[model samples]
Target: MAGLSAMEKKLAEYKCNTNEAIQLKLVRFPEDLEDDSTTFNPEYSHQVFGDDEVAFGFKGLKILLYYNAGNLSTLFRIEYTSKVNENFDCVEADDVESKIRKIIPPGFCTSTDDFVSLLEKEVNFKPFGTLLHTYSVHNEEAGEDITYQIYQADMTCPGFRDYHERLQTFLMWFIETASFIDVDDERWNYFLVFEKYNKDGATLFATVGYMTVYNYYVYPDKTRPRVSQMLILPPFQGEGHGAQLFETVHRYYMSSPTVLDITAEDPSDNYVKLRDFVLVKLCQDLHCFLPEKLMQGFSQEMLTEAQQKLKINKQHTRRVYEILRLRATDMGDPEQSKGYRLDVKKRLIGPYKKKQRELAKMRRCLRPEELTNQLNQIDLNMQHEQLEESFQQLVSDYRRVLERLAQA
Candidate 1:
């Protein structure tokens, strides 16, 4: 809610100014990254350099930025663009360092060579705790059983808090805000996913992905565990690991007495899909959301059951209700299909109705011609078509989730 800090403001400025003519300021010192300690992502460089910016071989340069423990580390890697360098107005290392210090606070190494050497050092990343949950899924295509393990660790865990710093750097590459949270605050909880396989008569583990949850206090003693950043590394995506991680976190909170309903912070489209699937799966087991009850239409029973049994809030519970109801309705029956469409349409029309009310209130303030012009822009005909199209697409999406739910 607060305004951006000086470093964030400058970074934003840098992002806006990036072009072929603008030379990179961080290229002089790799350790001069914007150190927010709150977020980082290598892909974010694209925000400044333009999407998929290519460096034609050592004639060009690439700049990377990351933050750890309140220290910024900038990386300047060169490619084959030597001829390209002669045309740009490059700043000397001293000026570049002075420019960086204006934004990021003081801390950490300022040497590019030392930073490169540190990256060259080998580091081991593995499961941070004993197994919390394990399940085997049959990969029909491969004709093999794949095993996944979910592990839990807190900020208080020995060596885990520090190890998480190294592990979470992966977030910078995938998540836009890849910086580490303050683990010393002791309010963050971590969940990790790993795949177990055997090699040379020994067991091996590969890091699949992870999620971070922050506990926010409600009135009195209750706590809300809001999911922060969740990443299923590219190699582990497209499988059901996301659902596995989400459901595991949901179940963990469901078992705790002091925790309230779970929530997520600015979830992406993929996460929303995975969450809907998992919530539907979990809700199906409750009596209130059974096929018979879902067909009876939504009621307080469904909301109360979902909140008490699964820690799902009322808004999400309503969404789950629509999805389940769609699954229950048979499109072959024209009457049942019409009822579902009407239900979804009513929700879709809410924004349009609100706009109409706003326009009516504005009638007295505008000239007759201006009012006519504004009303013409409403285009109710197009709105109706859009509403129907949206409802149809929604039903199609719901069907896909239902099919997956049935398989699961």
Candidate 2:
């Protein structure tokens, strides 16, 4: 999590890049971020890119570069500068930062570390690293709950200098999280959630998704508590307990003034899907309407793209599930329910977007008839599976009828 200065240095010095091909050329600034340059008014933020060379345009300075490695899209928050001065100063013809500074959203962290640093600085509490492991065993004879071992960290313990087990650290995080429920100052971002099982008074769950917040000034001044790998145990997977933990964590972030900026890298398909379910679906459940100013601050186009992806995934997932249920009917075993759910999740969470989004925009939007046709196709597909099962049942009945006829 470096800063703009470090990114700029990398852009200036790097040679051949990895991933996708690179292209570069100067571009006209998008309307949302432009001011008087090229005298063009547009509805949206426009961007210009090249195969080996990528150009990020702004009001004063623009970044023009060739990548040394990786796909161009894989590059995120890559350090490049066109301008940096608050004043419209351009004494240095090629001073990188001064030119592109306008393109970056205000208070956006240049690197993950920079964002975490902000979290540390804003809060007075000790930083606990992560949750490790946990398990529970039913003690039928003892008539009491038996937790095997839980690892946690207590970074804030008085005179407790030993960094010791990861368990201790995680416990500190859990207890502190509970304590912050009473806190009302503007410091806590969201009650960062972590899992811990207290067995013989030790923690097992290790902190996983190391995260931080950038006070958003997000929709309605609520902070989004982004999370990562923290888990309870296999036994807790679908019990809905995760939601309770999440509620506590988010309640802190949603307090009056704390805003959250959850930045992810070029995310995996599963990561993208999870974020959609939480940020979009669940947010909708919460009536997550942001003020125009705050909402405008977000990447509307990106979210639009995300919503589309989620719809496709959900459709495909339903298809797979329909197939599985048909098979289960033929097999006549309820045992397959567990496996079917797991497979459905994998497909639903996997990344599958591949069309050139810019060009896809050119495709005429679906008409009412076309929309109806698509639904008909899905229904037809599902109907075929259902019919197969019906046919099997028919065959079984015919056999029984034949036997009765023979007896007659």
Candidate 3:
């Protein structure tokens, strides 16, 4: 720990102890197929676990899979534990049959001969995509029209459950701590975005991205919708698809009287940026956040308007004020820049200033030498340095947002 910084020293104490990886094998109808003839390499494989490297919440951890062709009958799954892997647990198809019995959907057979016969009658049927909302945009460079549609669905929808299960495979590739959810619960709602296009003279819909939100009851007729997972696949990123998806979800809830507000669970930095941009855009159109009011500084008027109109919490509302104020500010002018810095630092220094007042009271009960020791713990110089560092970082982040706003 010699020469290590305070933060680094703290991190050095933590450790990750990992053993060998678990290999789960499932051979469907092993009896019917010839020995070693039913071999397959998963077309897609995804692991679902928590941050502490444990299954933590569920009965056990799981690996969702899809075979060569993307369809319901081709899907397979497994759930086991670290003990199973560490103990070198050898499981046969018959051993795991009961665990997977309830998981298999109706009409799907575990019997190899029957399952193979069912695939022969299977048609590559595309499930009907329910249209929740739609908007049109033009390909500015190509001078053509592009129609984007957003669909909302529940777990009870037939064929949709299979579609969603397959879609979550993308999360393992994109999100760091992403885990699959229990789709059997009706509280979960899905929002899907797709591009409606014409290929080979037939209208086709290609997926762009999706978001999953859980509705939590807020007592006495109110419901708070918390966004659990959101992803705009790599191919469609940087095209403002994220913003569109967010605002569309926001608008959906805003229209409902029973909904209190929307929140995100342990949001990542990129998701925070998307939320800020979407909120700012929505708030700017309201009369309370116009240039004159924003320059006057954040007020009760601003807080009330944001909460009533958009359901944005007070903490987020304050941050939005700073962002919009920065957009309206003339940073090149020394006076304007200094004023902005002072406003932010005032909020930042509040806790430090309160600590100073508390220390004065402690002086009454302690000796002069003891009082000095306690006072020394509250370093004014360090507080000032931290305040400046925080303010500068905020300004840098605000500038980037402003640049994006200009482009938008």
Query: Best by lDDT, which number?
Result: 3
User: Candidate 1: minimum summed lDDT over ten consecutive residues — where?
Assistant: 21-30
Better by TM-score, candidate 3 or 1:
1
Q: What ranking emerges by lDDT with the best candidate at the front?
A: 3, 1, 2
lDDT against the true structure, per candidate, is 0.66, 0.32, 0.67
Tell me how many clashing residue pairs each candidate has: 17, 60, 0
Judged by whole-model lDDT over C-alpha atoms, candidate 2 comes out at 0.32
lDDT of 2 by residue, 1-408 (tens): 578688665444432221111112111112212232322111111221213322222232322221111111111143333333332343222323432333322333454344334332322223243323233444556666543222222335342223222112222212212111112224323222323333234333322222222332447655443343333322233433333343333433334344333333344443333333333322322221233322222234334432333222333233322332333332344555444434444443342222224224434676767656555544545654654565455334433433332342
Q: What TM-score does model 1 achieve against the real structure? A: 0.72
Off by over 4 Å in 1: 1-44, 47-126, 138-143, 176-180
TM-score of each: 0.72, 0.24, 0.67
User: Which 10 consecutive positions of candidate 2 have the poorest summed lDDT?
Assistant: 66-75
Q: Candidate 3 lDDT, tens digit per residue, 180-255?
A: 8998778898998877655345554556789999999998999999999998765457778888899999988888
- Residues 1-408 of candidate 1 have per-residue lDDT tens digits of 245485344333232222332222211122433333322223343322335433221223333333221111333332222432243344211122333233333443445566645432312334676567898777777799989899998866676765565456556446764455777777888998877765345555656778999999999999999999998765567788888889998999999988879999988777777888999989987889888888777799998889888999887898798999998889889999888888878887899999899898879899999999999988889889889898888888788888999888
